[model samples]
Target chain A: MSAAPELNPAIEVAGLRKRYGVGDTAVDALKGVDLTVQPGEVIGLIGPSGSGKSTLLKCLGAVTEPSDGRIRLSGETVYDGGWHDLDPRALRRDRIGFVFQAPYLIPFLDVTDNVALPLLLAGRSNREARQRARELLAALDVQHRAQAAIAQLSGGEQQRVAIARALANQPPIILADEPTAPLDSERALAVVRILNRMAQQYRTAIIVVTHDEKIIPTFRRLYHIRDGRTYEEAGAGRDLG
Target chain B: MISLAGRDILHSWGKYAFTGLGLGLLIGVTLSMAGIYRGMVDDGKALLANSGADLWVVQRDTLGPYAEPSSLRDDVYRGLLGLPGVAHAANVTYLTMQARQGKREARVMVVGIQPGEPGEPRYLIAGRQIERTHYEAVADASAGFQLGQRVRIRRHDYTVVGLTRRMVSASGDPMVFIPLRDAQEAQFLKDNDAIVNERARVRANPALNRPGAPGLAETVSRSQESSRMVNAVLVQVAPGWSAAEVAETIRRWKRLQTYTVPQMEEILIAKLIATSARQIAVFLLILAVVSAAIVSFIIYTMTLGKLREIAVLKLIGARNRTIAGMILQEALGLGLIGFLVGKTVATLWAPYFPKYVLLEPGDAARGFAAVMLICALASTLAIRTALRVDPATAMGG
Candidate 1:
């Protein structure tokens, strides 16, 4: 494949550090980390337990403020030193998407409502939110079960719905933690393929955090974190088709 | 926008409905307590209405005639009738006693009324009113005395000739109407042994049984047999004259207590049943507190169960106010169901009470509003807990 033209980085971080407690009792979790990701790219994040994988994910997701860092997403500076330039909740709602280990769909809401919640929160009308959710569900190939209750769907169907929800607002970046850890090898590769197809179709960047070994070879680029720092690595790029 | 509260409730409707049913039973007890108090007041008013008298001329400086012991000479009506604006006056006496029919007995308020006067039973539901000068009685159906049944009062046996409805004393005691002479004797008569002993004591007194005074024993015996006192004089004011004016004249000139229709109503409602109203008010306060506590406990538990979901929603950009509103709406929905169930239950069981249970539409409306307000206030605790949840917990490391 030709070397793809790199667009302006969707996420750029520098000197990101986080510490818990104070004084002599303080323990550093993330020690001066730096990272970058371009739009329309799917990158894997892997680390041993307690290797600061979650801390880095929280800082990236805008859920936890870093003690000392500079974070710029889509050309907008979000965090610097001890302050955040944007509302964290609004940022999470409008620009960032999160998928979790289990498909944590709200049990009370139907599949469509679960997917449309972010769009609705972002001030879209019901019809508009529903239309967007339907398109995303159709893209994820789960449109037939959009109106079903979250509990009625199978595990795979539920995961697909969660993925649809993540792309509901067409956020430029998606952060998924342990997205395929529970699935077997075939299902795990299927999830990675779907993520790749979505990133290419929507031109969105995605960071997948996982420790599962079966699907690690599918990525072209990967980041391995050890001792609170990330190092870039080349993937196996094995063909599944 | 989708209503998170509505969707949650619909998802667990069975659980919510069962909880509401439990709360509704509590509310039903509260409403029934209120109705009981109203029944007592209504019974007092009914007693006055059934009396059919415009003025009650009682003994001097006393609130009696019904609430306390009262006595005036039976002949006082003759003097009261002579006054201007007094169209008719009748001597009436009230005595609460146990009347026996064969093997069964019931507590009844015996009203001594003169024939063809204002003190008689206003209307009958079954038989005719007392047409005889003696031995005929009219009993309220609640007293369980059937027509033609012989009921013994004191030493006399009277046949039940009439039955009335809605005639009760302030204390919910049914009433029985008898002739003035019989009622007076039944109320004040001594036993046979006591009468003999009284006669012997009179003879033993030298001033009363002088040897030269013939027929002295007989005269003394006649005095012992007669009942000269009555409870009150029931008076009717002439047309074009005010009852208050007549009552005032009697109070000033006759040196006796007089109560007009409105004044008598005050005595029955405010003075006679004041303590009962306070009792009911205290019960209402306790029930309200209990309802609030129960609602709070239920809502708090429900919110605790959904803590995980709330954290997830918060992490995904749900506002604190949105989550709080959802919890409050669920509590309010439960309260609405409870109030409807409570009101319906109270109304259905009202007629079964031994006493009248007056369920006013206005009281029910106020009760419903209060229930909703209380529920809204009670849900604040759960809402606060939910809003304080940290979105970081959803990560669940």
Candidate 2:
């Protein structure tokens, strides 16, 4: 019940590093990345292909074991030196969310099932999971299509369902990879506005990785990753209208 | 937890149904093979039951008169009837040959029995049992013969006087009953040219012609012209007499081979048709292996198609057991559909086979259990694939 501005910072990363393979063939994907974001802030991550943006996101999400780093989320130290204190799967499930460039909704499931899956996986009863999913879907203005198949929804509607799914578990941080890259300029800008509103309303910090020129200026803060390194910068933060 | 497998099946029911139907046809063939074996066993039992004889007295050390050839004297039944436990006995002959009705020849077991005796057809569906001693015959309904129809057996033509059903030999040959005298003549009667040759040879033998007696050669020729051999004696034991006792008594005192009803059945099923049973069993085994292989390949391919989805699920806190359960449930569903279709197809086509197809309820029930077990085992390959999928794959590359 805390307001977005009054909440503490949700993520802090320092000197994070990641490498693939081993010995002679190892390739360092993330060299030494450092960053932080307050709760309710919508930040942008921009970089060319193979510039280590994905590696940084993966380290932040705890999906890969970082070679060296310290990561803190919601005032808790989740990793340091050697993945200090949390089960990676539990950490990802209970503390983080994800949104992809494509909706990636399971084709077999309906909109409600796709949205409620994470909550169900977290051990919630079906009724409880469905109840939480419906609230988020309604907030995102896609509740009318709750029973529709994932394939039946339009591109924009499917993306809205994906955003609703990321919010269903009420995680402290969300990592979005090219959330609106496939949309038209107007639709892309509309998606950024929705992300900002969702962050402020839910008090969740969100990092969106994008190369879309149309929506890059919508964030107040941004990070530019190049050659396995990161640099912070300011965005336009101006209203789309 | 949400049911991943149930959702997938419901989403693509048409594809699953069509695949299940194809699998069902294969399953149907397996069931039919099993039915054919059962039918053979049933026919063996029915043949023993319909004979209405307490003991079969044949030539010493022979498996006749169904499984092998044995030629006992036609008058042996007379000596058997005077035994302590004997009530009635009759001469019976069996010959497997083609009988011509109109222009078509049907393979039949030509059974020659005494009229008004225990070895004749028990009851008739049409016409009467053979009334005339020499030229009348009683045919099984399956032989496609009608009353008063003339059927040719070898060189002789006989009128069909009666029709009966379910009277078949162990080899599935329909039975045609004729008088014992006629059958004996047809089974061993030689050609006229051979008889003529034999007569010339005999007339020319000095030991037989002996100039002292001119009629000796003619007398030997007349004896050769007549046939007198019979297959076996079908005997009915007296009231309160045991078939085993009678058979043992005949074997010991009469110095003849005798078999009780059960022993005859064993010979027919275990010895006569054992090779065929083994062949069918091998076929059933092959079909089972083929079914299992198809299930494994299908499940493995399906799991491969959902690699990304599995990774996402794993990242979102799905347990390994839940994933495995999903794959197993899908396999069970596939098996359920296949079994229903297979059972239906087997039942629908059973009667059309040339032989009886006995699809017992017990066999069907066993088949269902086997299919479920096979499906469960087959899903292990898919489960292993799903479990090996790394959750890190879901992160952007």
Candidate 3:
């Protein structure tokens, strides 16, 4: 097999716009937002409530369509001049990963299968997907609980499995929406630490949307969105020791 | 891909099993309803088969001996015997009434058949055929009659000398067969006081009591007390002739209604029991509707409870068909459970029914197919709702 090709600028968005409803009742959620992130970079997106942070994440994750935007993942155009220039669902499955505010792991599945789900959905064989899930779980320090049911796991362990699921297909980009909303200060910083380490090891770009104060200073770079617009700045880059 | 549906079911097997059991009982009732209708039709066919007649010759324009009332001269069988293709003919009478043994009584169809005649019981399960003609009767085992039991019909009591199996009327009434003369008398006989009053009234008529006709009124009064009329004449055609052809000849020569075996079957099953068949059909339709509704409601409710799980599946890039396949498989699984339980329970309870409940294998196969179809259709509502679930909702859950 040929070696996998590498792409720069893991995620790129320009003048993204999203509006809900039509006619006199329409409300603009995202207006002309522009952003970029490179491979192996972990960026923070922080803003007050109703500042278009969720709208931006939905647009990037392909969960919702943008009214007008230019989006590229791994240097390939996804949406430009129309809603779907590329197959949106296939693009999402192959190139993008998502982490929600809650772990939302399937209660019916065990911890290993929950993490292996994306690989399975991507059409990988069961043994291969499970092997990959085990490797990621070990790296995240939750491999001992691989055989446990989702409901049997602690909150931190469940969140760890969720992260493993996001990275299952080795996607070029991951969009985390309020992933630390339910965690305490220690657990929240631990989640950020894992994200940073996984980004470096896998060369995967990640964007975390958070309102938690405990882990805000951990990002070296932050993007503040206000009134559907973005302002980039630096973070405290605090040490965990 | 891993089977999401299988995993989910395994996780909650107890719940699924209990739900399936409840649905199974409803399905069992539906299958029994279908069996009851089949039994009614089988009863009609069996009633015709036991008569041992190839042709039924009755009064003109009447379907008789089983369905409608008809009366013919007792000597009509002699003339029918003379017709070509007519091997043998015998007069027969039918009267549906109560037969009492002490205080216990049973409603039965009293059939009048001569010895070695076409309308006689085909087989005896117990005891011997009637030897003494006057007060001997053969009763169906279904009527709970045993050998040597004396059953009273009208004023005279008759001994049950023989027992037959499956000897029943088209309406499922067990039969009590007696000699032709006795059945004729039992059908038309009156109380002694009423008979004496009838003779006196006839003598009082001046035209009949004329001086030149001194004995005419007496003869007329005696005639009024007796009858030589029968319900029908059962004819057996020779093996060389077609029953239809013989029936046509009889109808043309005798100027009476003639029904071949197939025609008699049509009269007994289609015309005689049409109302009962329609009632069973309505019941089957209502049961089918109720079963479908229950399945739909169950699946839809289950889907509604798992909205968050469905959203997460979709948001994680699981294809829409994957989610739909899970719901479809679950519905079909429920149906399979129901069908197995239904078939088992229907078989278990069939023999205890008051009427015969014929659970044919073919009908069970059809019932299986119907249950699967209904479950598949019932899953559509849940599938639609799951597909419409927005994947973004997981962000909140």
Candidate 4:
């Protein structure tokens, strides 16, 4: 097997645009947005409601098609004008990881399977997938709850498992949308600390889209999105310890 | 790959089992309806087989002996016995009425057969065939009669001498074989009050009670009270002769309607119980449709409940077929559980039915296939819903 290419930026987007409908009734959700995140970096994307944070997250996650854009993940172009790869589903499965506002752990699956699902979907053997999931859970400090049901976990524990699931495939980048919105100040900051630790440990680039102001100071870099456009800025970069 | 549907079912087994049980009862009723129809057909065949006859000779232009009423002279069997290729022939009478033993009563087919004749029950499970011509009777075990038990026909009481199995008519009424003379009297005899009223009316009428004819009133009254008619003559063909040929011979010379075994079977199954079978078929169809609807509604609701989960799964790159397969498998699993429960319950309760319920294995296999097919078809609605789920929904607006 070939080793992964040494890429500086885990995800790069240039001039991304997304529009709903057509003609007079159309609304542009994302307009020529440009952003990039390097490996081993945790950045924050903060915006008010209806300011295209979701639209950007969806475009970056490879779920919704961007009307026009160039998107590269781990030094490979995934979308240029239209998807360069025909199977966006496979691209998403192999390349992208997602963390949602709620834990959104599959209720029927136990923690291990929920975390292992991405690897399984990637056609890994069950044992290998489970081994990888356990490793992630251990790193996330939720290994003790690996066999527990999603319903049996606290909100913080559920979010931690969700993080483990997002890291299951060892993706180069993760898109987190409002992941800390449901957490308290301490737990939200704790989640940010975990995210930073995971990013450094796995060399992953994570973009957290949030309205939560509690964890904003922890990001070394932040992007402020307004009216479908983003402006990059340096953050307080406060110590999480 | 992990089985999402299996895990879901295992996690909520209690809910799925309860739902399966409810569906199972409906399926059980549907299977029983099919069994009832089969039983009717089997009863007809058994009736023909137990009669030990190759041809049935009834009144001309009638579908008789079982499907319709036909009256032939009591001496018709002697003429049938003399025909070429004739082995043995006997007079038989059949009347469906309430047979009572004290206060307990059952609807039974009263069969009148000569001792050691063609129409006698083929085998006895208990006791012996009727030895006396007057009041001895042989009863089918399904009639709930015991040997030596006294059963009352219309006017006289008779003792059950034998018990037989599967000796039932096309309608599933158990047979109670009595002597020809007794059955004739019971079938034709009128009540004493009605007899007296008829005699008085006849005497007052000059046309019936002529003063010039002294013995006319007595003759008229004797003729009114006597019955020398038999329902049909059961004939056995010789070993070398074809039943159709013998039936044709009888129809030509005897001037009576003759039916070979197959023809008789057609009449009993196709004509006698046709309406009842159609009714049962309609019921089975309705139950199948209802089962499909219930399965569809349940799967659709379950899929709707998992909308967010489905969205997440899709966003995480689970293929559309994978999601659809999960829903389809769940529906099939539900159907399998329901079918097992249904078959068990149907078998357990079949004997308690008033008529025989025949649950043939072939029918069960077909039923299983049908249930699976229905479940698969029913899951399509849920699968479509799951597929339509937007993965972007998981990103949240």
The best candidate in terms of lDDT? 4
List, for all models, the DockQ compared with the true complex: 0.66, 0.64, 0.58, 0.78
Candidate 2 lDDT over B1-397, as tens digits, reads 7788899999989978987898899889999999999998998888777778889999998999999899888878888988989998999999999999899889999998899887798988999988888889999888888899999998899999899988888888889999988998889888899899999999999999999997999999988888778888998999999999989989988899999998998999999999999999999999999999998888888888888888777766677898899899999999999999999999999988877789999999999999999999999999999998877677645
**Worst lDDT window (10 residues) for model 3 chain B?**
B388-397
Say what the RMSD of model 4 is: 2.5
Clashing pairs in 4: none
| Per-residue lDDT over A1-241 for candidate 4, one digit per residue giving the tens place of the 0 to 100 score | 1113354578889999999999999999889999988887889999898999988988888788899989988788889998885588887788788998999999999999999999998899999999999999998889999899989999999999999999888888888988898999989998988988888888889999988878887788899999999999978778887
Structural similarity to truth (TM-score) of each candidate? 0.94, 0.93, 0.93, 0.96
lDDT of 3 by residue, B1-397 (tens): 8888889888888978888888888888888988988888898888778888999999988998788999899999999999999999999999999999878898899998897888899899999887777899999998877899999999999999999987778777889999999999998777799998988888898888888877998898788878799999999999799999999998888899999999998998899888988988898889888889988998899889888999988888889999999999888888998889888888999888867788989999999999999999999999999999998887662
Instruction: Judge candidate 2 at residue A59 and give its lDDT.
Output: 82
Which candidate order results from sorting by TM-score in descending order? Answer: 4, 1, 2, 3
**Candidate 1's TM-score on the B chain:** 0.95
User: Which candidate gets the maximum TM-score versus the true structure?
Assistant: 4
Error of 4 at B102 (Å): 1.3
DockQ of 3: 0.58
User: By TM-score, is 3 or 4 better?
Assistant: 4
What is the Cα-based lDDT of residue B288 in candidate 2? 95
Please name the candidate that would achieve the greatest DockQ relative to the true structure.
4
What TM-score would you give candidate 3 relative to the actual structure? 0.93
* Candidate 1 lDDT tens digits, B1-397: 7999899989999988888888888888888888888888888778888888999999887887877788999988998998999999999989999999999999999999987898888989999999898999999999999999999998889999999988888888899999999988988877789888988988888888898997798699779867899999999999999999999889888889999877888888898888988988998999999999999999999999999888878878887778988999999998988988888888888878888888878788888888999899899999999988877766654
Output per-candidate TM-scores for chain A, rounded to 2 decimals. 0.96, 0.94, 0.94, 0.95
- Rank by DockQ, highest first: 4, 1, 2, 3
The residue ranges of model 3 lying beyond 4 angstroms of the native Cα positions read A1-7, A22-24
After TM-score superposition, the amount by which residue B143's alpha carbon in candidate 4 deviates from its true location, in angstroms, is: 2.2
Stretches of candidate 4 off by over 4 Å are A1-7, B194-216
